[model samples]
Target: MTFKPLLAAALLATTAIAAPAFAGTKMKTEMSATPTSNIVETAVSVDALSTLVAAVQAADLAGALSADGPFTVFAPTNDAFGALPAGTVDTLLKPENKGTLSNILTSHVVAGSYDAASIIALAKANDGKAKLTTLSGAELKAYVKDGKVYVKDENGGKATVATADVQTSNGVVHVVTSVLLPK
Candidate 1:
């Protein structure tokens, strides 16, 4: 089979074995030491972050994302992309839509390192909500309910943080099940 099919199978197997790997793992410094670049280098890295990875490379943001950012990225998984409306991913991947795709992906990222506590505090301070400005010039609103963090976009679409605090050398990553669309 082709690489994409093989990759999908591998990812499925890994997912079956791990079943939300970030959910139970504590944020250890050693685990955190896994460089974002290295993650991007690994065999299944691109598969796990298929859509966002493509967008990053297409947008020429790979170097910036691999740099010493201390950024906080809310990464959507392959399943999240699969859940998108039919043709959405294909359209985003087109050369003409590269800029738009990049903007949407980068909109999920914030400039500095923000841990869960910091995020929660920001939410509480804003009357249980916080508006975060992303590197892409878009805004994302964060709110905490029942101790779970939820992010909403300008278009009013929301995605819950399914797993949090997946730390990387360059930044922290929170896994969200759905894509957060920009207005």
Candidate 2:
């Protein structure tokens, strides 16, 4: 048995043994690399949006948001919710206040997907502010100030975009520094 032939055979055997494992890993990676989570699932996976997730569930808007939305959600973080007047979140979560909660939540969401760039461009074209009509028929103003994107509710409550363009299966989420309340 020549050394060269023995080495070649060993190399071939090693490649054959590794190929299946490599293929399996590659397939698994590809599967996981694609984002399959809808807006609700995406929100649930994000720790900072836990409060928002709870609010969505409470308002029974999770199913709607999880649908084939292509919605643009101005999602407020836990801190944003906490910064509200004490008892506000709790009150909104109550069964009797479901309508109010849904209104507020819907105000933060536009019907179509709008990434940061699109919002900014729209604002710029509209003379520094663009009105985004929500699912509730309420309008939220989007503007760029000092190179940062800001969303202002009809009542003048404003939130800075903390994180932008979190893509999901149904839509995209833009984390807001404060909850955008409806007028």
Q: Which candidate number has the best TM-score?
A: 2
Which candidate number maximizes lDDT? 2
lDDT of 1 by residue, 82-133 (tens): 9999998888878898788888888888998876767777877888777788
Please report the TM-score between candidate 1 and the true structure. Answer: 0.75
Model 2 over residues 1-183: C-alpha lDDT tens digits? 011111222211211111121122111101110256677766665567789989998988888987898999988989999999999999999999999999999988898988766776787789889889999888999876665667899888999776666667887777788998887
Supply candidate 2's per-residue lDDT for 129.
90
Q: Residue 144 lDDT in model 2?
A: 66
Q: What is the C-alpha lDDT of each candidate?
A: 0.65, 0.73
